[model samples]
Target: MFFLKDLPTRQMLQTYHERYPGMNAEAVAEALRLLRRGSLLMRALEAYFTAHTLSQTRFLVLIVIDREPGQEGLLASAIADRLDISRPVVTETVKALVQAGLLGSVPAPGDGRAKRLTLTLAGRAVLADLLPGYFALIADFMAREGDGTA
Candidate 1:
């Protein structure tokens, strides 16, 4: 219930300390440390994606497209649902990717009203170039700090 960053983390959580005397504040301290670590890691990933001509949202769109049926791709509505983002946001991302020559949109093979997205040669190359680093970051983080190995 604490803001968690209201106090310099080296400072003990007074609420936890005072609410239950003799109970060590180690739990609160550990939680704070984990939160800070997760936050910084997310920031680092965001920066890496941004600097490399990719955004996580759009990258996710690409991933969905690759994973979906036909490797042919899905409609914006399907992508929005799969990514748990807004339809409008998905639309914009698809447009940008299409413009960047990373994605191509065409009439859905079965549905005239919907557009199917497919990655182009350049898109595949971009994904190939970016995936190794992204996987490395995840692997390194989990290897070093993740608690659940099972």
Candidate 2:
């Protein structure tokens, strides 16, 4: 996360530019603002997920499976590959979901050692309950990008 909540002022960057020849103050300032905004938006999403009783990782895992078509599910490794999160984190999240009765797992047909992960009925129920609000939140965030409200 971008920890610096307040971006450096243009004047400050310009002053620094005198010391560092290559410092493009305007470009750097714009980039910093963009990063700060992105961080804020990420925090908003995390807050929304937390309010709905899900962590970002858990929510991602659910959505990845939900987006897949058919009764057959996806493998844990496949999930790890599809997401930016690490394998160990994904594995732990899947385990927690399974224990919570929000996810189900079955052995792959050809590969008995690999498990195919799918959403349980409770998982679908949770997604169905939360997705509408989630979409609205995302829509609002995206809308700000075009209107300069962000």
Candidate 3:
């Protein structure tokens, strides 16, 4: 969330360069512009996820499972690791997903205490329904970037 709507002006950055030796005004300005664009993209994604009744993490969890080599799913631990998030966070989200009938857990083979998480029919349908809008959002954003509007 780079929330600085008004990025520093070139003149301001040039003034900063005078006060701070070795400061690159052009580089700094370019970096800020990139950050602002990234922030815009993230905000768009956040809004999209919210409309879908999901957070970024929740969306990612579903993606991680869907992207696995087989239609078969991964363990909660594996998902957490892949997402670089904590176990409890993954567990909590998974619990909610399961409760919503979007996910299912079965006892892990050869590991009675562990569970493997899989997408339910509803989950697959949700992804099928949701991805077009998601991809379109991405394409729209990238198109704007390509047009130098970002």
Candidate 4:
């Protein structure tokens, strides 16, 4: 079976030239490279997360809550804002983490309706366990890129 990365750049340029006529081959090649790299990184992350029984969003939420200072934790809205994602998405992710016992929520001191999220012991432990490997993988990738082998 043919793979995207297996396709030669010259062949890609020729195919794009045939299809789009005036399309810029250099721009198309760069975009294809970026897309392939993104796909590889995402698949790697997905596999890692799946092995740990964690979703990327849930892991991100846990990290956000864990990084918050003091014992009060953070609001779901705050997480949404920090992650630049929608409130509903944060809410759903928080719900899943809470259900999994990885997160705890309490009513905000001044606001009865607002809940502040905090990482549970399990959450902290999981993050601590996974972070070393995650950091190592990133470091390795960076090193490879630095050596022009990526």
Candidate 5:
């Protein structure tokens, strides 16, 4: 199933097992290596969010809210605007985070129909704890990718 090249990328090489006898183990090994790197990325991102009492989407919503133009944040609808996703998506994400105490919502005080968002202190602490592991996984990933040391 390889394209362009005679050999598959490490990730692709993993698909073949019993059919190809005498296949290069090196290819399989390299695929394993790349898979590990990919896994590290997910683990890092996941750990960063989870440690902060957030899911991946919730962390993204927080980042968007924190960096919004006013630095004061936005309504659930406005957060949806920043997300490039649907209103319902933002609504759901915010609802869960609010329940977890990682996020809070206050009325816009202007629109009356809108709710703004903020992160709680416990949420910040969780983010702080997660950052180091995230950084380490990233460093490990970059080291493996940028150099042939692995």
Candidate 6:
């Protein structure tokens, strides 16, 4: 007795099962749910970053530099690798952050072709101000989900 709202997904699940007898409908449903939840969280975070005049990419770059050990800036390539982002995107974001006075860069020691990036005072301040609220949002979301209220 499938409800009307469940008919479409149930049909899709049946179709998948027919095409691939080993398909696990439950796993597929769970994966889809996880993706949807991730999308929603990203959208919310994007809006929050926008309010601070920052893009998610830029925020990510800032945090990477901020978390660097000993506050020693990291090369652009290192940032890209650590964040699993493309080099071009990291380069562009770094350039923007530098222009905004949220990041500072210097030539990497013994690497004439490489530049190291570090978070500026302003960047640290911005992250410090926003992190508490960001963490609280995550905690609240987790609590609601745990209680089946989200």
Per-residue C-alpha lDDT of model 1 across residues 6-120, encoded as one tens digit per residue: 4344344666677779866876566666676676567667788999988888888888887775876678888888888888898899999999999989998767889988889
What are the per-model C-alpha RMSD values against the true structure? 4.5, 2.1, 2.0, 3.6, 7.5, 4.8
**Which pairs, if any, clash in model 5?**
none
**Residue pairs with backbone atoms closer than 3 Å in model 4 (clashes):** none
The alpha-carbon lDDT assigned to residue 71 of candidate 3 equals 63
Deviation (Å) of 144 in candidate 6: 3.7
Candidate 4: global Cα-lDDT? 0.79
Global Cα lDDT for candidate 1: 0.79
Better of 3 and 4 by TM-score: 3
Per-residue lDDT for 109-135 in model 3, tens only? 998878999999998898898899999
Model 6 per-residue lDDT tens digits across residues 3-115: 13222376888898999999998777766666666666677778888987997888888888787778678899989888978989988889999999988899988989999
Lowest summed lDDT window (length 10), candidate 4: 141-150
- lDDT tens digits by residue: candidate 4, 15-73: 87999898988776666666666666666776788899997778888888777778789
Residue 86's C-alpha lDDT in candidate 5?
A: 85
Best by TM-score: 2
Global lDDT scores for all candidate models = 0.79, 0.87, 0.88, 0.79, 0.69, 0.80
Alpha carbon lDDT of residue 150, candidate 6? 30
Number of the top-ranking candidate, with lDDT as the measure? 3
| TM-score of each model, paired residue for residue | 0.74, 0.88, 0.88, 0.78, 0.60, 0.85
Candidate 5 wrongly placed segments (more than 4 Å) = 1-40, 47-53, 69-71, 147-150
Error of 5 at 39 (Å): 7.7
For model 5, residues 1-150, the per-residue Cα lDDT tens digits are 122223356555545544576678686666655666566567667776666556667777877765656646677876777777888888898898888887778887878778878777765665666657767867876876674335
- When 2 and 5 are scored with lDDT, the better candidate is 2
TM-score of 4: 0.78
Error of 4 at 139 (Å): 3.8
Ranking according to TM-score, highest score first? 2, 3, 6, 4, 1, 5
